[model samples]
Target: MKSSIVAITLMALFTKSFDPQPELINKGNSWNKNPVIAHRGAWKKNNLPENSIASLKEAIRLGCYGSEFDVHMTLDSVLVINHDADFYGLHIAQVTYKELLTKKHPNGENIPTLEEYLKEGIKQKKMKLILEIKPSKNDPERDQKLTDRAVAMVKKLKAKEWVDYISFSYDVLKRILVLDPKANVAYLNGDASLEKLKADGFYGADYHYSVYQKGEWFAKAKELNLTINAWTVNSAEDMKWLLKNKVEFITTNEPELAFETIRAVQSGN
Candidate 1:
């Protein structure tokens, strides 16, 4: 009995030692200087292919605050990183992993599994993995299962600290909170009222720049102590506006441009 007890204790120790997120979550304040998120893995500028591991690495190399990517599950339940509903005419949700292996990304990399992507992410602890869980078209069941599997994968990898979950589906976002209340989740639909988001206990809001401009959501977010993240804000003018508004994170296709704009703003140029 003593031997069995010792083995169990060792297993628990191993699990705790592997937890990737050893530090507390950053709640998006002035201290968060690294606010530039590489949308779709910094794919636009250097001709690097979107959703490829190469682009992810480039994002890391550039020292962006986060690298954003999308994930969808296969018919066999394997999770793959990609941005589109279909890959080269192959529907990701309808096919098997083996069939996917036959295809390659624009960079010639095989469609990466979630494990593969996270493994790469684990190599560098500086950047957050902005994981966007894509909703399955007409497949609500699969979407829920995918959220569960995604949370499981992150826990198994001990990457809770370095990952943030974002989704357009309210159901999926809610499921993420139910699965892990401590998770940093953002609603992507850009429609959830600030009062509702605060009431629901979400981490923040990730919406289009227009959403922020059209209403007082940014003010409400500040009033409610929620982080504000804007998506695809590639224009220098828009970036300037968000920066002035103190938006916590800016997801952009042009990380390079964003960096330049931020530097200029800081210098009062």
Candidate 2:
């Protein structure tokens, strides 16, 4: 009896050592200087290929608050990073991961898998990984599968805190909340009202820059205490407008210019 008890205790200890609980990996990391989120890493000024690891690194080097990238699951259910449904004329959902990797990005980097991207992202503690899970408009089943797999991968890697999710599909974002209610999820479709978003439990309303201009969304978002973020705002005028309104985040391809604009606006130049 004594020998059996000792063996059981030792086994429990070993298991605990190998299987630790998931916790925030970047718990105390400092907040970024500005609200600029690199639209697809920081590729434009440097001529690097968007969604490539090189661009992600550049965003980190530039000290952007976050770097947004898109995720799509291949036919074999491997999550790869890119901005479009078709990569270099190969339909991503129809091809296997191995086949899709045959073509190199314009910068000569193999299109990065979601795992590879997250690994690089977790290395630093500052920049948040704004992961946009691309939706399959024609196939709802595929979207759910992609959502499940993406969330599972993030959990498996223990990277929950380093990442935030955004999607144009309401179902996909809802599914994310179902899977991880504590997740920082925002809707990207731009049609939902602030009240609707708050009722649906979204972290924020991530809309096109024009969406805010069309209505009283900026004021309503503040009234409802919902976070506000505008996407793809590359022009200086639009950046100034969003910054002046005090939106929480601005997704832009021109992060360097956005920083300059932020300085100018802050200094009342």
Candidate 3:
């Protein structure tokens, strides 16, 4: 009986240690000054191809807090960065990385492998790489593989310090936690409640701006001490509303305008 009790005690302790509190994630890291997260990097204004290294660098140059990018695994198991499942009409998962590379970004850069993206992102320490692991269309197995490969690569590159994760796929986010419980993860599907997120070991609620407007999610998020981030918010008016409500992060294509709105809001202008 004593031996069984001891085993149970050990299991409980192990579980407690593994499930990290949301507040303690990224404990020592100092993020950028403002809450602006450049959506697909700062690509819109310069017309740079989204998910290109050039665009990632531009977000860093702009001093945004985080630059969001998408990741998908190729048929040959190489992980590459691109927003959509299809790259120039070829489905990314259906082709090998080499075939995908035959096409280049409008800027002449090839679709960056996850490793290449991480290496460039780690050059500076101020900004974060907000990696969104895109789910496979209808393949749960592929989705799991993608999640596993992405996490393994991040660990191998030691980029965990510079990377946080966002995903529309709840399973992907959950798998991330299983791999690294302390990872800063947020949900992007905009359907899960903040309470559900917090209970499920998520660090934040990254919903669309419209999702928050329909309910009392903003207030609930604040009360629960959950990080609140809204995505692709480009309008100045929407920016002002989110800023006035004191959201922690705003992912936007118009990061420069976000900065301007942040300044104006701070000054009560």
Candidate 4:
């Protein structure tokens, strides 16, 4: 009996040691002052598998304002997180989640479902989730279904406040607006006019970094009271320029560099 008691105590101690403690996240409008969004969850520099849960957790640990990730639906309507249409040679749109379960990311994590991803995301309340809803290329019907399911799941999870939906498809973004009139949506296509965005009630513009370079779109977006976010900005020069221009958010593969740049700018160096 004494040996069994000691074994139980050891097991309890081991579990306690391994349990992850939630970090104290900065709250409310904290991201307003120049946020650094980790594109694909701080995966690039860390050599971690992109779009995996590990990547997401790492972003939160790094205190990124947001972690950007892509979501696609399986044949069984399970919303899975991945950047590409295919996973381990199996097409995500054509395969069931059960089939996907047989494969794993390079880091040994199974393709995470959107539900699973969001649950993980919510654990770190300070980090916003930049969810890119990838549209179906040839199937408009499937595209609509994907959008519908994504909206529904996010609503059910009560995670709307933490999520910012972005898409290259104007139609898909419009459908999201229809589903939740208050949903924060950003247009990914860099060509849209600020006036058009303002009139259509879009939350902001998440365009390519270069799109803001040549035009007065940055000034125009600010004029319209629209939030501006630029994507995949990796270079120190680009990062510094964006910071100087006062872009609201910078999505980058090089989050460490981005952070350093922001600190330098803030310190007036």
Off by over 4 Å in 4: 1-33
lDDT of 4 by residue, 180-207 (tens): 9988788999889888888887888899
Between candidates 3 and 4, the TM-score winner: 3
Off by over 4 Å in 3: 1-25
Give the Cα error of residue 177 in candidate 2, in Å.
0.4
Residue 201 CA displacement from its true place in model 2, Å: 0.8
Backbone clashes in model 1, listed as residue pairs? 20-158
Q: lDDT tens string, model 3, 145-235?
A: 9899999999999999989999999999999999999898999998898899999989888888888888787678767878888988999
Q: lDDT (CA) for every model shown?
A: 0.84, 0.86, 0.86, 0.83
Winning model by TM-score = 3
What TM-score against the true fold does each predicted structure earn?
0.88, 0.88, 0.89, 0.87
For candidate 2, lDDT tens digit of each residue in 178-256? 9999887889988888899899988789999888888788678767767788999999899988877767789999999
Off by over 4 Å in 1: 1-32
TM-score of 1: 0.88
